[model samples]
Target chain A: MQTKRMTFSSRWLPYALLAPQVLITVVFFIWPASQALWQSMLRQDAFGLRTTFVWFRNFERLFDNPLYLASMKTTAIFAISTTLLAMSLSLLFAVMVNRMLRSREWYTTFLVWPYAVAPAIAGVLWWFMFNTSVGIVPYMLEGFGYDWNHRLDGNDAMILVVLAAAWKQISYNFLFFLAGLQSIPQSLLEAAAIDGAGRTKRFWTIVFPLLSPTTFFLMVVNVVYAMFDTFGVIHATTEGGPAQATNILVYNVFRDGFVNGNLGASAAQSVVLMGIVVVLTVVQFRFIERRVNY
Target chain B: MVENDRFGSLLAHLILILGVAAVVFPVYVAVIASTHAPGTFLQGVMPLLPGSHAIENYRTVIFEGRAQAGAPPIGLMLWNSFVMAMMIAVGKIAISLLSAFAIVYFRFRFRIFFFWVIFLTLMLPVEVRIVPTYAVVANLGLLNSYAGLSIPLIASATATFLFRQFFMTVPEEMLEAARVDGAGPMKFFKDILLPLSITNIAAMFVIMFIYGWNQYLWPLLVTNDERYYTVVMGIQRMVTGGDSEPLWHLVMATVVMAALPPILVILFMQRLFVKGLVETEK
Candidate 1:
């Protein structure tokens, strides 16, 4: 909310500057969002002949529907697991890289470039690696007396999607974690070490507590990411498949709207998605405001 | 206690090395697969070593495409992705720069109002309102056009905030000096503010370009025509081709090519990319 101390006394120019951004926001973001809100209340027949305004009917049906509940459950599991996997791995690497003296740049570069791989492409790479028949991972798994077939097994499909989603996300989490690790003062660790605390003890007592804010931020982001952004991963690899095992809410909305032609239901789902994003955004900004003090 | 312990250093190195290998393993597999004969994948486990088909597979995919899947040539798709990324990066930066400048320097009425309106975009991502956004684009007849591919994505609240934050840190004397020299606002911005922001702009460009290039669902939804297909979404078509197992060699080749540009951007401008990413979030 801060502005310049010295001001430019321009009247018409400010309006001209803001016009294009305002125009795009209204048309592309605000307009569509309001449309989704309105359409969620109206249902049209298959023939597009009869339309009825049934307020909250789509939402009611969605909650009552088993598949929607399952999708929500799947999203929860996927989000939590992806966050844990991506964050923990990144933190491990970040901590280790933090300890290095010479090879930090090389290791960081190797880990970070994966951030550039598109979610769908990352999914394809992982999918090919776990592709029951020809996949290297599955072949390796089978050697351990365990069968790995994402094609038919729902659990396997979920695991595959999670792995792919986590793979794509690791670089992002790694960067943040690396930055977080680098920002931690060495004096604190030295202080702890001089106090007779071991390396592991220093991490748990000092390093982790200091890194909490970064960890919390990454958690929210990774959850939002697993919920929305991983649509590409699911679509490209599993298609939320093997019996809706990996069906997340965003994918369901796309399916309901385009593939199923249930526009009203899809609009309702979009509204629900909007509500979630609003809540998440609120959490993020509020946390950031508090973080300023910390 | 302050000793430089060799055992601890060795352990750290080993973990980092293993971590690096795990990160690179999948892409390594993809690269190796891209090099193999199409017939190799049909026989059991994918071959571990690079084969002799790398040139042929990349050539076929880039020039010819897999017609059966209705995917366009990789050369064309790559061009579309590049154009889309460039337009999005430039357009977002331009609009955001102007808007941020207005909000920061000028004491206009509804300045706070305009700031909140722009910030409204930060809450709702495109995915949350996909159906209606699609309808908006379709109504404007933007489907299958380059404009459709890029324009809907160019409005960026993040860039506006980033520039606004950076501009606030600029010393007020620069502006007072510019005005004392009889330079108009536009001239001052071009002369003083613009050059000052070159590094910030470059950093933003790297981040936004990757974001633009990696867009999968938007391009998938808006463009049905093969002529407009981006390589990221186009990969889905190549992999899901019919039934008889995707031609792994070319498919992996397509994957490599589709991911190459953004990967190259990150590798080259990593410092800028990391700076943009962290600062924008902050």
Candidate 2:
């Protein structure tokens, strides 16, 4: 809420400046969102004619629907696993890269470029790598008496998507974790070393605790990411396939709306997603406020 | 890090090298795959080494495209992607900059209201509200156009907030000094503020460019016309567009093409990319 102490008096100029953003937001963001809210309360016939207004019927049916409930569960699993896998792997790499005196930048440059690869591209690459007939991972897994076919097995499909999602995200998490690790003053580690604490002990007692804020921030981001951003990861490879095994909420909204042409259900899903996003945004801002105060 | 522990340093390097290999291997495989002939993929496990057909595959995919897949040339799609990325990036930075300046410099009624309106955008990503947003765009007859691709994606909340935060940190004396020098607000902004904000702007440019380029679902939905296809979405077509299994060689070639620009941006402007990403998100 802070502004310049010596401020400009021109009222019209400010509105003019704000006009473009406000226009785009209202037309594209707000109008569509409100349309979703409004349409969620209505039902249309299968023929897309004679719509009838129904109060909360779409949402009520959505909760009662098994597939909708399943997607929420899938999103939870996918988001949590992707966050864990990405954060831990990146944290380990960050910690190790942080220790290197000479090859730190070299390793970092090598590690961070994956952030640039598009998620859809990342998914395709992994999908190719895990392609059952000729994939290297499957070829290797077959040696261990396990047949890896993402196209058929729901759990395998989930793992494939998770791995793809996590792989694309590792570079992002690495950069932040590296920044967090770098920001930790060396004097504290030196102090801990002098106190006869071993490396592992120092990391647990000193490094891990200091990195919590970064960890929490990345957790929220990665969850939001896995929820929404991994649409390409699903669409390009799985297409939410085999069953509804990998259909996260965003993809479901798309499928239900565009593919299924179930306007009512899709609109309801969009409204629900809007509510989720509002909650997440509020949570993130609250944490940000707390962090600023601290 | 504080102690000179040789064993620990050695162990750290070893772990880091392994991590780097793991990170690079997929792309390496992609690169290797792009070099082979079409028959190479169908023969079973893809060969790990480079093949002689590299130029032939790259040349075909970039210029001719896979005709059977009904996709346009990678050259055209790459150009489309570039144009869209530039528009989205520049448009976002321009609008966000103006709005942030307006909020920071002027004390106006409903300023807080306007800020919240902009802030609300952060909650609703395009993925969450695709149906209704698409309907709105369709209503405007903006579908299958560059404006359709970029405009809806350009109103960024984080960029606006970042500029606002940066503007706040700028010392108030600069404004007072500019006022004393008989300089107007716009004049002061162009002369002083823009120069100071170059780094932030460049950093934001890197982030937004990648974001715009990496977009998949939005472009996929809007631009159904082959002429408007972007390489990122076009690659998906090469995979699923044809009746037969995808021509892995050309598909990989297109993948490499689609990924190369943003990857190069990250490689060259890593500091800015890191700054923009961390600062914007955090």
Candidate 3:
């Protein structure tokens, strides 16, 4: 809410400056979001002939439907697994890269370009690598007398999508983790080392605690990303198939509304997603506000 | 150093090497796949080494797209992707810059309200509100055009917030001096503020260009016309070609081409990309 001390006294210029952004927000963002909320309460009969106002029935039906509940469970598993897998590996990489004096830039350069690959492209790459016939990973798995086919196995499909999603996200989490590692005061670590604390003890007792704020922030971001931004990963590789094994909530929304024409259900699902996003955004911003003190 | 730890240093180096290999393995496989002939994928495991058909595969995809896959030429799709990314990056920056300037430098009514309105955008991502938003765009008849590709996506709260944060650190003396010289508001903004913000803008450009280029769903939703297909979405079409297994070589070639631009952008402007990325989250 702060502004410059000496400000411009303009009646029209400020409004003019704000007009374009406000216009686009209202037209493209606000109006559509409000419509989704409103449409979640309305139902259309088969053939789109009769429209009936049914308040909360759509939401109630969504809760009762087993598939919706199943999709919710699928989403939670995907988001949590992806977040953990991406964060832990990135943290390891960041710690190792942080130890280097001369080769840090080279290692970082090698690690960070994958952040630029789109989620859909990342999915395609991994899908090809795990393709049943030509995939190297499956071929290696066969050496251990194990079969790998995401097309038929639900667990295999989930693992495939998680690996794809987490793969694309590692570079982002790495950069953040590296930045967080760099920001920790070296004097504190040195003091711990001088206190007869070994490297392992020094890291757990000093460095890891200092990195908690960054970890929490990245957790919220990774969850949000795994939930919403992964539509492309699902769409491109799986299309939420193998008996809807990989159908997360956002993909469910698109599939129900666009592909299956279940408008009210999809809209209801969208509202639920918006609620999740609001909670996550609030958590993220609150953590950010508290981050200054740390 | 506190202690000589040659063993620990060696362990760190070994872990980093393995980590880097894990990270590069997928893309390495993709590049290897792109170089092989189409028949190389039909009978056995994908080849680990590059083949002589690299130029042939790249040329076939770039110049003549696989008609069986319903994909247009990669060259046209790449052009569309570039145009869309540029428009989105430039448009978001322009509008957000003006709005952030207004919020920082001018006293206005409903300022807090407008700020909150813009902030709400951070929560409602395009995926959650996909249906209604698509309806709005379709209602406005913007389905298959450049404007449809970028304009609806141009209003960015992140850029606005970043610029506002940058503006707060500017010394108040600059504005006071500009006023003493009788410079108007727009003039001061153009001459002084814009110059001061060049580095931030360039950093933001790197981030936003990558962001805009990597978009898949928005482009897929808006453009059904082959003339407007972006390379990212076009790759999906190639992979999902009806019934038969996709032509792995050409598909990998298209994938490589699709992912190259933004990767090059980040590599070339890594410092700015890192700065923009770390600061924007705050």
- What ordering of candidates by lDDT runs from best to worst? 3, 1, 2
DockQ each candidate and list the results.
0.83, 0.84, 0.91
User: Which 10-residue window of candidate 1 chain B scores lowest in summed lDDT?
Assistant: B64-73
Docking class of 2: high
**Best candidate (score: lDDT):** 3
| Predicted model with the maximum TM-score | 3
Per residue, candidate 3 scores C-alpha lDDT tens digits across A1-294 of 999999999899999999999999999999999999999999999989998999999999999999999999999999999999999999999999998899999999999999999999999999999999999999999999999999999999999999999999999999999999998998898888888999899889988999999999999999999999999999999998789899999999998989898889889998999999999999898898888775
Per-residue lDDT over B152-243 for candidate 2, one digit per residue giving the tens place of the 0 to 100 score: 99999999999998999999999999999999878988898899999999999999999999999999999889889999998888888757
Off by over 4 Å in 3: none
**Chain A alone, TM-score for each of the models?**
0.98, 0.98, 0.99
Cα lDDT for residue B56, candidate 2: 92
Better of 2 and 3 by lDDT: 3
Tens digit of per-residue lDDT, candidate 2, span A106-168: 888998998989999999999889987667899889889998888789999999999999999
TM-score of chain B of each: 0.98, 0.97, 0.98
Best to worst by TM-score, what's the order?
3, 1, 2
Best by DockQ: 3
Clashing pairs in 2: none
Q: State fnat for each of the candidate structures.
A: 0.90, 0.89, 0.92
> Poorest 10 consecutive residues of model 2 chain B by lDDT?
B65-74
lDDT, model 1, position B215: 96
